[model samples]
Target: MSKSEEASQRPDTPHYENATGGWGSLKGVSRILADQKPTFGAFRTLMRQNKPGGHMCTSCAWTKPAQPHLFEFCENGAKATIWDLTRERCTPDFFAEHSLTELRGLSDHELEKTGRLTHPMRYDATSDRYVETTWEEAFEGIGAKLKELDPGATVFYMSGKASLETAYLYALFARLYGHNNLPDSSNMCHETTSVGLKRVIGVSVGTCVLSDFDHCDLILFFGQNTGTNSPRFLHTLKAAKERGCKIVTFNPIRERGLVEFADPQNPAQMTVRPATRISDIYLQVRPGGDIAVLAGLCKRVLELDAERGSTILDRAFIAEHTTGLDELEARLREVSWEEIERESGLRRDELNEVAGIYATSKNVIGIYGMGLTQHVRGWLNLAMLVNLLLLRGNIGREGAGISPVRGHSNVQGQRTVGITEKPENVPNDKLRELFGFEPPQEEGRSTVDLVEGLLDGSVRGLVSMGGNLARAIPDRARAEGAWRGLELNVQIATKLNRSHLLPGRATWLLPCLVRAEEDMQATGPQAVTMEDSLSMIHGSLGRRQPASPHLRSEVAIVAGIAKATLPPNPRVKWDEWTGDYGLIRDLIEATYPDKFKDFNGRLFTPGGFHRGNAAREREWKTESGRAQFTAPEALTALGAPPEGQEITLITLRSNDQFNTTIYSFSDRLRGLSGPRDILLINPEEMERRGLSEGQVVTLECAVDDGAERVVRGLRVVPYDLPDACVAAYYPEANPLIPVSYRDELSKTPAYKGVPVRIRTDEAGA
Candidate 1:
């Protein structure tokens, strides 16, 4: 029953203060259409979610708008399509009336409201529950536990909600069942924006193109919150502030979704002009202060480029397209504007007014999130924000680049179709010249080496393919005790989270079909494809049908577990690739033909195509053929607490939560109601910690070599956070951080700057 016993000491508080979107985004879209009291077949399955004829809103990656907006979903994408068109049902007699230990004391939002998992069950273990079965005996008992494990002891993971034809046929059936170990959900949030934008801009997604935030004239956002993680990126920052741009905003928690949003399709913000105020300059900084406010705005754009008429950088694109510019102007003159104002609580006159609005912006861009990649030098805070957007030549041309505002929606197309755990340099020779084998060249196992290979037993086997990894990992009793020390887990799900109640010694589940449903398959009616976060791709097409016709369609349950564990293959043809997902997009365009070229005729091209960016055409595929400049060394602070009553914290996602979906424990833009054991904190550090405002407390935080991290009770509230900062909500403070804290060069989970220390609720009074 633990994931910190689903945060208790309930404390409601909320009385409106988070000023984002008007009528609080039409009351969080009328409380997700009154908790999906739906049916006109769920209102025609919410008019095909992101509509280009159907399905796309796998929540937030905010892209779709190249002229298409008849309500392209977004109240958290209409509560992720009313939390997957829920009408409720766990079926098979609700697992013969509940028992995996009474569904492990419920809450992972009450096991996703006890709904949707329909058929394929398994786990009997002398009737501890979950019985139903047979999709050919649950794919031959998970292909006989992948033939009694040891293709480096099974891992797979995936889950940024699958599709890109089920993560390229679940990495071509775990590299034709020998295992590349895969790992994904981008190894826990933007694998430091794909290994720090592929080492400072060669590639690793984000080159900008949501029309580059509409002709960028200046738009920063480092460590973004964009009105609660992509509240439709505040209508592209309110149409780039009515087209005269200049946004700014870094965070520590000013967020009312970045100060002013209100577009419930604008009724002039519900009667007369006033809700589009998005940041002109907000800058709170401090939780592992974005590489000392990007090294004091790249050392004040190198003292305004050494003053002789003050040009401010771009010395012919840093001597022809980059390469460590004089060791980044000697590590920004050996750090010290008093250690960038003691590690960016900001002010060297707010880093020269943010380097004079980034040296008079001639097309800039930046935007960031996960507070610049959950730190431990989150890949040197995205290489000091690409060394402050290459000091001026703000990435590849017109209306600038760099974006990284990621968070699901096809997790950059499941790591652009292959879901790596490092295939010793991806695109494994275009998947060994279009699947003739030779792929698993080892080096795999990421979601932090599969929870340290399920706590050193060398990982025992889990398939996952849709995430809830014991409530999104980061130590919650060591990721549910290494997912209850797996023996073979499986899960290809649609609902019921808490990693499907962790069982394993062969636990199963299956279920599936949810990108707005209907996937007729056997070649006659299916559609798939995903990618967005501006690498575009598109083609969703679900059009609502399978509420539970025994579900299956995460590309037919990874093609029925790859034709029940591959014993005969004609160089890969799993039942004519599970009745043609256009032959798995023609073998993913014969394995990445320069990014799926004409991949199904660009789904009749409306707003799809782009997948382009190698720094948008000034190419530079690193290893010396340019674009490098790294420098960053003065981190100054994030945890030197001893004289401060230590705080830090961060965590996030409550505006009706998304990743690890919890649609409404009521977070109407942070007024928060029903309760997820609250936290927030800094009203002058709760009057310098005598603490009050709904008190409760308890937090703790353990890290130097892990374990003992706390949590208990919580409540607190006070907020407008900063000194000794604090904030909570995430699979409820993901059990106070430490699943090996992280970012040893992008392993990710430092879940937004955690340090911790609160206390007083002493085991909840």
Candidate 2:
């Protein structure tokens, strides 16, 4: 059998399609708690997952209310906490028992759940094990490698999960070292929002805050699984529903989160089990076809405007605060109804129904997720959302604007605190003022570009501040190979992951403090600041003991490396900065003065203060000095596959998964358990492809690159998805996607839309 065919054979697990949240979530929480078997020490970490004077859930960015409930967390949130705060340890002894080849063959869940790294380790290629090493030796080893390479050849990849304090020092060290190759997790998720919002609105930040959900006349949700990905968001959505606001959704699959939800917090929901209908109009959209559905709505709005004039379309606001409407309307009017129906997988009447709800509502808040951003035309999706809201005069209103939900708890905060590859975003003059050095002026590389650099032999060293970059990127095999070819690799993480296994010529595994662990520094127990999806910056102070005595804070790790690599009189006070985290915040405030004014006082604010949004106050800071109605002059090129390919593949997160982190093997909503080796295919398509339930199959990429990218051992399962749109778990299927498949504008991998061919694995038979 071919390697691809051999790779396709694996174990089997049953899937259970069950209701999301409610009693099930309670049971899940109980099971996880029992798994932790939290002693008083672990119990202390559990109670402080998301409370005042305590750390927020590091899992999701759903912010806590100013007056939050005593328990403002969910089952998944508990999983993230206990997983990070686990007593289990993967010490050097464990590494001695497992070889590199042996560890690579383990499932992602098994590797992470094995537990946190107890000490620093250096890969011993001779023995194929990671042996314990002193902190000084590890730093010196990494520092020596850094001194040998051009700073530009070193890539400092930052995870969105890194705290503001850590990100500040990481970016500072890289810039001071004369390079800006700081790619972040945003490149894989919402970089489109930052690019698109800045193109349309004056700023990349969201205009709406959490309170806007309370007063919105309508809630338009697009492709977000709130129940699983952001369970706390269900509270806001349910509240909107109870207020008589119309809710509409556009998704490729009918997510249970959108269909119906029972508030786990409400006592009545436990017994009555009455589901609050979330979406009044749920349209099953086709992958990468959101534009057509949105354009159809806008086209309908134009027809209404033609009949009764622009009053229903916010003419006054359009005239006063926006430009490009005539161009937008002209293009929208040209779209044919047939094309809309065909591309969107919905009829004209169904669209007209949504148009009716949208046309009548006075205030609307648009919510979207990776579904909108991870596409070839992902930025256009955001543009469409902005155009929809702009047409309705939703900006600068009581309950209106766009809300782009983000994943990691502090992904936005990383970008906010100088985690960018674009030199234009670095504010060189400000850095010169704060650090007494001219920052590097050259533009840096993003994640995709970093992979390209690695393959082309430019990136020599890598310092990843949390994340399994090797498994997280699209082309896993290629990413794995390129990183292994690097001269040096350093990973600062809370737990062991696949990236650790991809050792360069020299590899160092350094464990860092998680959000729950107490961070003591020269000043005192340090507090780190984080920004949420809503652009609220607040404090996160650790309270629990360090998971391992040898573990260091991310801030300390960065400082230690900086001390080893840089000159004796490096202008920045590395020791002082690490000693007091408040100094880091003070430096940040100095760097971005206007944005961080009163930063200290606001850290103690009830729910953190807003970071100043232009659109929120009806302030337009664009070159035209007004919010603009942005519409594409024409439809983008079709992203569909050619004659050979029949299926469109989407990578999905099971209810138990968090990004690339496999929290559990079972998925609550998908009814999948034990194994994540199955693919969700449309029943009719499965039969046509000569496949059966539990029958192993191989998925082949259909691109014309002359490269056959295939993933094997996929257990087929019939599902309620759009025809020819199959779903599978990522990192497993990551190898099947080419790294070249990404958004042109934002450079984000188009994880949602991969064209592939499926065939039953009758190879050896």
Best-matching candidate per TM-score: 2
- Model 2: weakest 10-residue lDDT segment is 2-11
Clash number for every model?
Answer: 5, 6
Every candidate's lDDT: 0.76, 0.81
lDDT of 2 by residue, 705-739 (tens): 77668888888888767776899987788887777
Model 2: how far is 413 from its true place, Å?
0.9
Instruction: Give TM-scores for every candidate, taking all chains together and pairing residue i with residue i.
Output: 0.35, 0.96
Clashes of 2: 6
Give the residue spans of candidate 2 off by over 4 A: 1-19, 633-642, 761-765
Residue 534's lDDT within candidate 2 is 91
**Model 1: per-residue Cα lDDT over 1-765, one tens digit each:** 321122111233333453576776767777777775544565665565666656778877777765666676666777777777778777878878888788888778778877788788988878788889779998988887788788788888887767788888888788878777888777777888888888777798888887777789888887777666677777777888887897777777666777667677766677777666677677677788778888888888788778746477878887889888789778788878887787777768867876887887898988887777887678888877887888788889878888887778888887777878778556777777766777778778888788777877788888888768777887766667666668889888878887777787888888888887778867688788788888888888777767788887877778778788777766777777777788889888877788888798777366777878878887878888788888876573243433446667888877778878786687666555777787877666688778888878788884556367787887777756567678888877787777677787877887888777778855743
User: How many Å off is the CA of 585 in candidate 1?
Assistant: 6.9
